[model samples]
Target: MNSASVISVVGPTGTGKSALALSLAEILDGEIVNADSMQFYRGMDIGTAKVSVAERRGIAHHLLDILDVTEEASVSDFQRQARQAIAEIQGRGKRAILVGGSGLYVRAVLDVLEFPGTDPRIRQRLEVEAEAHGMAELRARLQRVDPASAERVADDRRVIRALEVHEVTGKPFSSFMPVREYIQPTVQIGLDIPRPVLHERLSTRVNQMVDQGLADEVERLDQRGLRTGKTAGRALGYAQFLRVLDGEATVAAAAEETIIATRQFARRQSTWFRADPRIRWLDPREDDVVDQAAALCL
Candidate 1:
């Protein structure tokens, strides 16, 4: 009876993963720990869809909004904090429900991968190149070094991170990647809906964020001088909003750009989660996602 068994709610954005996690937390007397990268920052509410105090439904949540927008938070930071929270919850004889759409952060927590440590010189070089030739070019270079890792992480940021491993450690990125590690006593749940439905929901969700003052949130962060180099500042909506704030783009254009970027991010999440065998994929229309999760937990 390892109460430490994690109940992880994972899916692309706008799929009600948070809602499912909260409901299961309440039913199972569990505590929820955020796995989303964006949701970890303070003052990043609307666009991150951060669970508000009221919306927590009197359930305890961990690792949300503990960092300033100017801080540099990475997968290693997340993994350390998440593992601590999980241990604490299990010590309290409660369950830990890991919830979010950030597939990298989620996998880092569930698996045994050791993310490469950062090096100042390599990072400075990559930053210069990333801003010069673009993140795509760096990602392509990573593909030449390790195609398997590239497929598992088919994006600029992750590919850049894997590249960092190779450059810093003088080892192929895959050489550092951990072999498959089961999350002992853990059960994973992935949520999915029809593509049309999901996209429609995504559109409405973005519009709702606009109405809920996401622009103002970004503006506040901007006023604080939290530029795009910081983790929180680089969050999708904030980056687009930064364009509008810089007078580099129009409101309509920025909003459209945000939507387009988010859609592509969701596509990548689906690709990774679909390939993760640990997750028990479930339809969003399933009669009882929590019940199914609890069954798996037992």
Candidate 2:
């Protein structure tokens, strides 16, 4: 790692990404950095599966729960905080182990994106359009405007973001996501799990979260006056549960809907990682993930 490299763990949720990263941190003398966007909140613990201090076990973790739920933390903020975390870990003669399923957050921190600073007017107007015309409409707009880019990222969030970039930077958003030169000499590892098994695990996890008072957690956060527009508020489980609260769906329906949405999101994540040529993919159950990862780093 040349004393300054970062170790990145990425994949869909239920792929043992956190477990693998924590294990690798202990073995490799590394400090864990939170890369998941939802885990960055303080109160939403169970649903986010935030690593407990006991789980961290004093190995030194960074950039988790640094912002209040009300604050709007952007990709730029993640990049800034992540660099500081890596520098601190490197300064201590330890490797930095990044752990999460938030590929955009990981990519932003690793500088895979040439991430132009956002223009407020462009974002504000687009956000308004997204709210008015719906995610589908905005996605169609992106397809019409940038067909090639649309094929790569058809999600509502990415579509809106691409439109914002085009409006502000006069360039397509896909340009930033593929700027691989911005990355350090990072060793990327992925956890591979079968699709059906992954779906079962996600369903079980969501149920466990509900039993762990996920509803109460969301209610508390809601009372804090956090807006729906904020990223933290739109976390997978919480976002769907809010629909139940609004009488739009039953609790069971919400849970099932969340599971389906998550699985689809996972598929998209898998595709995104596939497009990156530098990553080394592996399975948690096959051999030692650490041994395989260490071999790659060396």
Candidate 3:
């Protein structure tokens, strides 16, 4: 592997990205820089499927467990931290293996995308619009200004941010879309699975998380003010389990909802990653998947 090149392992959740990243790190003398937004929180272990220290096989991992649940995760922050980690890894004569399915986070690290500064007054106005007229209204307004970004911004928060960027920069948010250029040499290996197979896998994974005490995990975090967290509170499994804790749903019902939400999230991940032509696709189930990825890095 080229010492200056970073290896990125990305796919939908439950597609063995962690496993592949571990393998690549073992082979390439690499350390990991996480891009999974949820994994940034300290105690969000089971639901995010964070690889335990024992599971990492003594390989170094960076950018995990670096945030409190109450703090909002900023992509610009992640981009800076991740690039620093990668540079340090490479400076130490090791490879940097980037992992996770968060597409924008991944792009922030690898692409030449510039984040426009936010104007407090503009953001305040957008927030008011979102609150009074609903996300659909702001989304429709965004479509008029930046149709491409409007298509990608799914949630109220992102829609607000996109509009804030457009207002602050006097440019459409879509005009800031990442070009096929890298800040540094990088190789991205994407794991691909059939939709039915991925769905089944995701369902089974959610059940495994439940069995592993995801509900109890959420309850513990709740005591630490997880519900008050802007970002952490809305995580996939944690949010559903919070409903269970509130007596709004049964554990079984929460699990079902989590499964459904996870499937939808996976579809979005697929769409985000499939648009990147730089990623080399491979099947995680292939016996030599790690070798295939390593070949690309070389």
Candidate 4:
């Protein structure tokens, strides 16, 4: 493989993406660029399943733990940083491996996606409309105008962004769907796990997180202003645990809800990535996953 080739390992959260990426980096003399949005926060290690220093096996990793819990993650910002990291790694004659299950973040790094400049007036107007009509109504309007964008972006913030883009550019947000092309020389590998097994694994993973003091982690972050952060406050496990802190639910109940939400998220990720034909799918249970992916890279 050329030194400039970028390899991305993507799948659901519990699919062992980090392990595969570690192996690939060791074999390919690569450095990792993280694409998981949640892992951007510095102290969100346990909930996001960030690989520990020991697990990284001394491979240089970039873009992990760069954001505070109170900061909103911007895909556009991440795109810039990730591209720079890739260039730097490849410039050093090493491989650049992008690893995560965040579908849009992955595309932001690899695809020819342009982040449009926002108009404050348009954004303000959309915020007012969302406040007056509600997020569901605003999302419904976006569904009519840009169904493709509406399908993937369900958050109020992202829906507002889509509408703002449409108003500013006079183009449907869906018109920006990434072409089946890469901005850089790249190969993508996806893990294929059965739904039943994935769901069970997700549940077990959530249980493990709880055992690893997820509640305490959330408590620490909450005290550190996580509640004020628009994006981080709504993260899957942290949000559920916040309810636990409020006495609205038990930690057990929170874990169950997190499991369900993670399963749904995995389904969405699967759908998003399956639509891309360039990704080479492999069964994670297979012993030769690293070899299979390395063959594609080389």
Candidate with top TM-score is 3
User: Which ranges of candidate 3 are over 4 A from the true structure?
Assistant: 1-3
lDDT of 1 by residue, 1-298 (tens): 3546888899899888998988888778899999998887888899898889999999999998888888877888888899899989989999989999888788888887777777878777887899998877887788798787887775466677778888788777777765558555778889988777887788888878888988888899887766944677778889998888889998778888888888878888898788888788887677876687677776
Q: What is the lDDT of candidate 4?
A: 0.91
Better model by TM-score: candidate 3 vs candidate 4: 3
Cα lDDT tens digits, model 2, 129-200, are: 878877887777888877778898755666777888888887777667646654677888888688888888
Better of 2 and 4 by TM-score: 4
TM-score to native of every candidate shown: 0.88, 0.87, 0.95, 0.94
lDDT of 1 at 29: 88
Task: Name the 10 consecutive residues with the lowest summed lDDT in model 3.
Answer: 1-10
- lDDT tens digits, residue span 234-256, model 3: 99999999999999999999999
- Candidate 3 residue 81 C-alpha distance from true site, Å: 0.5
| Candidate 4 residue lDDT tens string, 1-298 | 4546899999887988999999999999999999999999989989999999988899999999998889989988999999999999989999999999999899999999988777989899889987887898888889898888999786779899999999889898878767777987898999879999999999999999999999999999999999889888988899999999999999989999999999999998899899899899999889888899888888
**Candidate 1: residue 23 lDDT (0-100):** 82
- Ten residues in sequence with the least summed lDDT for candidate 1: 176-185
* Local distance difference test, candidate 1: 0.82
Separate clash counts for every candidate: 0, 0, 0, 0
